[model samples]
Target: MADAVFDEETNVLLSQVDIEPVDANWFDIETDFVLSQFNLDNVLDMDVKSGNFPYSQTIGDLNVEANKTETGNCSSKRFNFEAKSSDVKKLQASSTPLNTQKNTRWDVNTWDDWGKWRNDRTISAGLKESAPYVLVPPLTVDIGAAELCHWMCRFILEVRRQDGSEYPAESLRQLCISIWRYLRDTCRRYDLNFFDRSKPDFADLRECLDARMKELNVSINKVKKQAKPINRTEEDILWSSVFSLNDAACLQYAVYLYACKLFGLRAADEHADLSVTQFTFGRDDVGQFIRYIGGRSKTVQGGIFHKKVLAKDIKQYANDSNPRCVVNLFQKYLSLVPEDGPFYRRPLATKTADGDQNTQHRRLVSIPYRSSCRECAKGQVLTASRLDTLVK
Candidate 1:
């Protein structure tokens, strides 16, 4: 009525606001979409801007090329700790001196645009080699392949993020050996068969790793004359552990510990990681966790698989939480994990175990946390659900 008294045309325009648009975050992202899991009212401080993201197939037949689509959209999110975001942006702005951190320029955008820039640097270095090495002059392409090992080493054993808090630093020597094994297996496609002496890329590191592997095997033989070999299937036998999932609460932890003992999982105690999909309920509603594959799964045939789990025929299993200890663990620990974070993950103890003294120390001291995540999204996706007009 007041708007009509001042300006009738403006009032009509205001009244005709689209319901979806009015409820959304000023972007096309729907409130119903967010509200399906989180209360839209709980979120605060939103800033809208243009950003870029890519959508592509997770894995495809090598003969088939993945279709690529690049889109501009909202990129980052900040909930609490406004100061942390400020600090990062400030550091980004303060990058002044080019070639400051070694010949590497800070102007490298995307945080991953080091390809051409690094190639340019390599040639620049190769051109500066001294006289005696002229006959064996390094190729224009040089970024000490040893540094590649170090880059991977950091990934293998660096301090892992524990949901952005509480970290324990540890060396990744055994972890590197595991990674070396995986790389030696994976690099085969790129003509980098590290295990084969004939492959060109099979060089010093692979040879050393091979020798080290033999040495470790010999050492392990000397030490473990009586250790039982429990393969993955044997370990994941949860009816053997504190079994079943009758209670929504208790089944949660049993599922977690089963992952831990069976799959060498570490982060299942986190509730947010549990998704509607992970809860594979049978016709009888008997639910059980199946398997989680990594995004960079060589098994999945691509760089990343967006969906982590495969619904299997394992639901004929069990759901009566008899032992009750697992229920205690779930209530005391797993229940506290955010309802929207990654699902179960392998523990540091499992991933990095090899009789390393330091690893043992950390296992005794550090809390378990997952650096990896399985995205939690429901198959029953929410769309343009909106509030009724005039509360009718």
Candidate 2:
């Protein structure tokens, strides 16, 4: 009887199940079951609560309140954007204005200082009253090429040495060249149209300068006497004489002579400006020597024109066995002098007076050799004049 009841129930379930064939576009069709599962009202209510749907009216009065709040937020954002843009415009208006007057010439004060120095040089050279060709600021004065040529001729003819003697041909030529350089540089800086080589006046000026230089050279050569150079025998005699003397003054003179011979130092300010620090003791494969560190020289003045130029290396070798060894003399001199003072100093001495029956005799009193601190304090050194007279 249970089997009969199970079969009847299975048959009844099968008869109630509807087995229909699905269409080709079955996913596109929305059946009643899918439509009933998704509620549009609930989705609209959720969107309104989350403020995603601005036109949602399912919550009637709340919709109007939400719209008003959203409108105020948008208005506030627009106002902030407008305010930022206006502030940017105001900043641009108040910023520093562009400099309309473009300055081509650099450093006005430097040019003015140069003008003053040129004036002083002219006065010292005794050409101020005669030539009277003052260099003013560029573009302010109109100096023609002819005028420049005339001024330079006058300068060359009238310039004299401190002893009131005429300048040598070389010196006059150099002065004229320097003056032309100054004028050319000044014209370039101020963008003036002067010293044009293409023009006839400039050509004529150069021709005149060349002709005058040739004539001056010829005249100077006729009168100027050539100086004789000291021979090796004379140099040996000088060295022996300097070495024989045991006085402090003679020792200093020996050191000066050695420095001039070994280092090729000029008879001018090179010896005057020397300090103790420039020399260094070093040794190489050859032998031991004292190295001299070269600095600003006559040809190289450490200016912009001499950039990246290496200074010359001057060295004096040691001759320990020799009586007039430069190294030994220098070391002995160093031992006698102070560390901080100049390389050259004045040797000190004392004087004594002896009274006899008829006359009183004053003589130099002998004392230990010492350099004078008072003379060094007075800025005195071995001048070129004294150096010239040492051997004589």
Candidate 3:
């Protein structure tokens, strides 16, 4: 009513107040047709003026603006605008963040864009690298159920690790299950019919896959039983020479071994999660107890693991000629480490002369706190490869 009153007083139409003059040459009819397909009628409200059309839409303060440029043909002008509509919002909501840390869905977008070719290319690439292709391709929608069963069997035989060992049967079964889940989820997103429960098409494929998985589970259990823990003799040898070692790498590794045993941390978990700030000391009746919160890993049941050790337990391992004392070693390691940083660090080169024992001892004992240890502090945590080498 107010707009009509004002327009009548000014002798102008209310609709003409904010509307832009349209020129048909400035409008792209094909683009308008595409927008109309999604029922977004109000998105680009173009009006015809002098056989020309200019797009305009206004809702409250929101308005669509288009930049027009005349084509060489002169009969048409290209219209470009920032597209923001309800369909775009729906798409943004559907796209979830992938689990890149685990590398499980690292190639999800690439695989989706390339469709079945991504799976085939992955298999070919894995074959060339001699690594097990854990990503099992789902039975193509166009293939028969019998063909899927045949493909599954062939896939199982073809998959092998970089070390030339076949994937454990349990892992193969898991891969199949994971692939099926991925296919079903993706199909649901696109509103496609993936499988019919009432039909017998998938029955044979399911039966054969389950049977293979059962056989593989039994073999997996046997392999798990045969697996052994780290040798105790090797642990002793590692700690025994740690005191005589002045090398930064050796010291860093010694700290790692003791920390692993003290906290029962997995190699990957400790390397990634263990930092200088994770340690704290408390007093008890026995003596001081050192506690640490270990980082999370795949095998770790809880997201975080808390472990504590009595200072005396590590003190027993200490000797005049040996730095096997976990507490002392941790303290020395802490002196060189940054607060809230990685507890284990890669070493820098030694500045002391190779033949100068006194100088090396002085350098080790006189390491300045809060000052950068020259050629001996790389600030990196111990890695799996480094851990393996330290063990050997």
Instruction: Give the root-mean-square deviation of each candidate in angstroms.
Output: 25.1, 23.1, 18.8
- Per-model TM-score versus the true fold: 0.26, 0.47, 0.43
* Model 3 Cα lDDT, one tens digit per residue, 279-357: 7766666665566754444443332232332211222222345445566666665655455554545455544344311
Stretches off by above 4 angstroms in model 2 are 1-142, 150-171, 181-200, 217-227, 243-245, 350-392
Which one is best on lDDT? 2
Model 1 spans with C-alpha error above 4 angstroms: 1-194, 200-255, 258-272, 280-313, 316-392
**Candidate 3: which stretches are off by over 4 Å?**
1-168, 184-202, 213-228, 242-247, 299-323, 350-392
C-alpha local distance difference test of each model:
0.33, 0.54, 0.47
State the lDDT of candidate 1 residue by residue for 167-195, as single tens digits.
Answer: 22111233333333333332323332334
Q: Candidate 1, 206: how far from true, in Å?
A: 6.0
The stretch of ten residues in a row with the least summed lDDT in candidate 2 is 355-364
Q: What's the candidate order when arranged by decreasing TM-score? A: 2, 3, 1
Better model by TM-score, 1 or 3? 3
Residues 1-392, model 2: lDDT tens digits: 34654675465555555557777786755655566677788888889889998864676577778989989989887555555787876764433222211121222333344456566776677664454355533323466655655544444455565477665666655555444444444444332222456666556556666677687777775464432343455556545544333455666666765676566665444655566677778899989888888766655456666777877688888987877677777776665555543566655443223211111122113211113211321232433332333332
